[model samples]
Target: MRALTGHPLRPVTEMSPQRVLLVNLACMGAPALLIIQGVLQHGKVDWFAAGLGCITLFALVALRMFDLVSQVHDKARQLDAVAHIDALTALPNRRAWDLELSRRIAAARRHGSPVVVAILDLDHFKKYNDEHGHQGGDNLLSSAAAAWRGQLRPEDLLARYGGEEFGAIFDQSKLADADRIIERLQAVNPLGQTFSAGAAQWNGSETAEELLARADVALYAAKAAGRNRVYVSSIR
Candidate 1:
């Protein structure tokens, strides 16, 4: 209904108009020709011709049906992707981040691996927005998101947690590894701006929410100490 979210202006159907016409022609034209042939042959039914026509009709119908099903499946997948993505930056949004954190925590507990969570806030983001227009701020944010996303490992997750803030989940990583990755993200970002981050490796007994809260506390500490640094939570 919404043109499959990001894919706007796409044709209503995945199949082209010409292809649709071709399918319809094969479905109807072959049967009509066979019937005409039977009539011309003194109504003695051209069994061979009719059989071929029937097969062609069924095959065309099956092809069209499969294409429709595939289109539906693709559309559904696009919708799901849209739901989890930030419209501006095309990065995973807060909802996706939350789910990923829970998933990673569960997996880490099972495998006796570490799950590191971090919260990053752009330094003096308000000043940047005030100096540059909203559009400029948005461009900066998107660029930063892209750059940070590139720094993540296959086992890591980076998501926009709303307005100038991002969340990261490092599966099978400890606090030290998280710090290194965050430093890397800050270093590579094209915005030429710094961010303050707070991170904590998941403790065996804590929930994802508790883990995030600890990271948040550490993040605020980083802001209090200096603008461009990372603080690791000391609580377990």
Candidate 2:
């Protein structure tokens, strides 16, 4: 009755380990004080002796449970982080980009708005890697992706499209808008790090696959044009 009237102390079942340890220490220490007072006054030690063992057991159990829960939470967070990032470049990976692309494409198609697809392939990338070594190639790819991402709108979709290639999907964008973006991306990337890009605005005449193939042809044309430039499918 006295304990209930003072205030309701919350249960320790959900409390953190540090808090639980402090509370248990306080509880056990109080009993020791009471026992010392009782024994000194009347030669009795039952209160302290009885409560000490139970408090010790409870603290051990709480600490064990806290460690287990913390380990599990840490593992879950690591897995979630890995799911969205590319293993190679640590960029938001192809899987994450694909999901965003499908969503944007559906929205654009429904609203009768324009969307642009740009495919970029590094010019002479194999030769560059062969001459510079694998580590240099990895560094170049990482730098290129970062530069491209920096030039994109917050809503733009960018993904590494296999070896030495990348894909970008820009919704509600025109050819001129895509051209500006490509220029900015190229400008920030390293010198001699040139890419051929093919861009196409959605025309309702082609599936995504067909549209991408057309973009690839334009990319090849851009490469044939001496590289380091953007070409639209309409121009091709």
Candidate 3:
């Protein structure tokens, strides 16, 4: 089970070896003492054997309970991953992106750090899907996500916001630096595909929604101008 789940059973049990030993001793100590007393007083092997059997039963039950708890923990982790991750591209989904954006905004407000948000939309994605099949489009999306993720810093987050759209958050980074990173991602797009992006720096007072809306506005502006360029939102 540990091999299949790729997680340790210890974390789910939440018990150290010392604690587990103490618990086992507590459960079996009385029976063991009774068996010893019976053996010493009456010299009966039957009494000792019965006590040993009971202790073995208790140990087996404890082991089963621990296994069940570990299974539950593993299943819960799997469910969480399915909820927050996009199945197609294997990237964080829109819900995860929203939560992360809010978290980054809160951290920036508290620490006076910089936050840059960008929205990128693949150019002519629907047309590409029409020309190639949906499966082809999916493969492209997955490939593009892998390529773009490789180009980003580990601290930066890039998520699949929705169909053919990705969201990025650059933490503790200047807007100019974030823009350059986005350009690098654009260059690495798979199959010679192009994407238009819009970026906005946090104003230190606006909500996450407002900041993203500004970037979305810039994205529309970029699409209107041309479909393969990056636009920076004007500071308000």
Measured on C-alpha atoms, candidate 2 has an lDDT of 0.77
- Candidates in descending TM-score order: 3, 1, 2
Stretch of 10 with least lDDT, candidate 1:
1-10
Residue pairs clashing in model 2 are none
Across 92-148, the per-residue lDDT of candidate 1 in tens digits comes to 899989888888788888888878889999999889999998988998898998888
For each of the candidates, give the backbone clash count.
0, 0, 0
TM-score of 3: 0.80
* Model 2 stretches astray by more than 4 angstroms: 1-81
lDDT of 2 by residue, 90-206 (tens): 666667667766666678768988888999888888988999999889888988887778889987778877788888998788889998998888888764678889998878545
**How far off is residue 179 in model 1, in Å?**
2.0
- Lowest summed-lDDT stretch of 10 residues in model 3? 1-10
- Candidate 3 regions with alpha-carbon error over 4 angstroms: 1-47
> What TM-score fits each model?
0.77, 0.65, 0.80
lDDT of 3 at 222: 92
Clashing pairs in 3: none
